[model samples]
Target: MSPCSSVPEAAESVSRFTERPALQSSKTLRAAGVWTGAQQTRLNVRHFEFTADEPHKVGGRDQGPTPMEYLAGAVNSCITVVIDQLAARQQLTLEDLQTYTLASQDTRGLAGTADVQPYAHAYRLQIAITTPERDEHTLRQFAARAEHICPAINLLRDANTGLKVVWSFTEQPTAEAAERLSNAAVGYTEEHDAPKPFLTVTNADLAASVSA
Candidate 1:
């Protein structure tokens, strides 16, 4: 029997068929008692309290991931899981996998200023892998397979997708906290204050670094 048809027709049982298929539209592929819809393969995420050593200290890091950071983490973890599964099936021992995901979201979308709701304008990803005894050809094949099997990649690329904002809240900022943050150097946000006039203490002391 094909993958779409199986005994014990239930939601959990049907979930097994969520793997990347042969790229056939539901209309093109007809199977009796088969359900294929966005709801059938929806991606859900839950948040937990972030904990890290000395998270609240001025210089101490939070050691835990933020929500936006987890978005990128999901892509990397999905690709890694797919690669590991395929490698195990092929009797290939995995060494290490590295995936880099960069997503540029329009804040206007998040701020409800844009017509689009998802806020995801575009996402770019690069995967670098280091495996023992695996040649470049084999690595490329694995990479392609991983891309095909990753569910997050599929959902991100799906045309009929929407970003579901379940819940959001704002925290009141304290006066001390506000002042400290406001004193920081202006990099991305608009610079309303003018720079102080200063004489050339040292002419051409150091070359300036340009940043976007």
Candidate 2:
């Protein structure tokens, strides 16, 4: 603990800190990714070091997961985290939860086709959840809440990438009910929009200096 002006002042500071509004996105969070050649990208995020690479066919040594795989994993992880929080808040017991991400890309733009998306611009995620006692409606509601708030999925949705959350319930709902729930699940309800991202590229030396 640092020197405090007074006990009450310290208490007030703590209160202010705790009551401060949360950041919406990555306001101050920063990560550094260094390209170490041969399709390997080394990353440092909050003191944790990891790597992203491509396959051997793509000119990489097949060392680790490809960057696309990392992106899918990020979305899956974020969805799970949000769902877990929602379940805990709702006092729902989850026996198991599994998620699959399907991301498709059209290379027409890469082939110089006009108005075609080059990168991954299509995605669909299917989630299968198991619960011992919760109603299907409750779980669907939780999923909707999760999608509405999950940063990663929202980022995808905001980019206009096609994403729909399909469901498979292991406890109670019939096929028809499940289908209805799936239709109401976040992605299915919204009008389709194209997703876009703001990306910036800089020289390696400049990036290094900034991180340093």
Candidate 3:
């Protein structure tokens, strides 16, 4: 189901908690993954199942999104849902909403580089929303609220990752605007430094070591 489809129900649910603080409670979410083979794994969350794998060049079957891609998607989806719920609560009409997320990590960290961290060091969240609210202040307020409350966003923020959020507000959607947003989303990643291996060890060096 589309994330927006649950907005009304989620908004009502949140309202109940606000009206009665006693309704609030913490819940734990869980997922498990089993290594299948060659950098691939099968994951289970609740009753849903999916696969995670590296690309063929990275020595996997290229079956599904890599783990980092999933992390970026999680951030995007969580913030989108929060915006939808907030709009419902605020009585704002949202004609459309979309988010694009890009995470930048140093692959050198994965290869055991001492100074580099294995996880994403920075993230960019690009949001485009079509809403009737024309006041820039009101739109900024809404964006701030969503950023403050989004769980996935906070997770990376708490870890000290540099997060840049870019928002575009429009009274109506346009194909030209969407194309620009899409290009901007990709540009953020392209403009950033690309991930590169730090280790000088080559495949031949590893093979010689193994033979010796």
Candidate topping TM-score? 3
Pairwise lDDT winner, candidates 1 and 3 = 3
lDDT of 3: 0.67
- What candidate 1 gets wrong by more than 4 Å, as runs, is 1-65, 133-137, 159-212
Provide the overall lDDT of each model, using Cα atoms, as 2-decimal numbers. Answer: 0.42, 0.61, 0.67
Clashing pairs in 3: none
lDDT of 3 by residue, 141-171 (tens): 6766676678887567666577767677766
Better of 1 and 2 by TM-score: 2
Q: What is the TM-score of each predicted model, taking all chains together?
A: 0.44, 0.64, 0.72
Ranking by TM-score: 3, 2, 1
Task: Write the number of the candidate with greater TM-score, choosing between 1 and 3.
Answer: 3
**Stretches > 4 Å off in candidate 3:** 1-24, 175-179, 185-212
Candidate 2 deviates by what RMSD? 14.5
Backbone clash numbers for all candidates listed? 0, 7, 0
How many backbone overlaps does candidate 2 show?
A: 7
Clashes in model 2: which pairs?
A: 159-194, 159-195, 159-196, 160-193, 160-194, 160-195, 161-195
Best lDDT goes to which candidate? 3
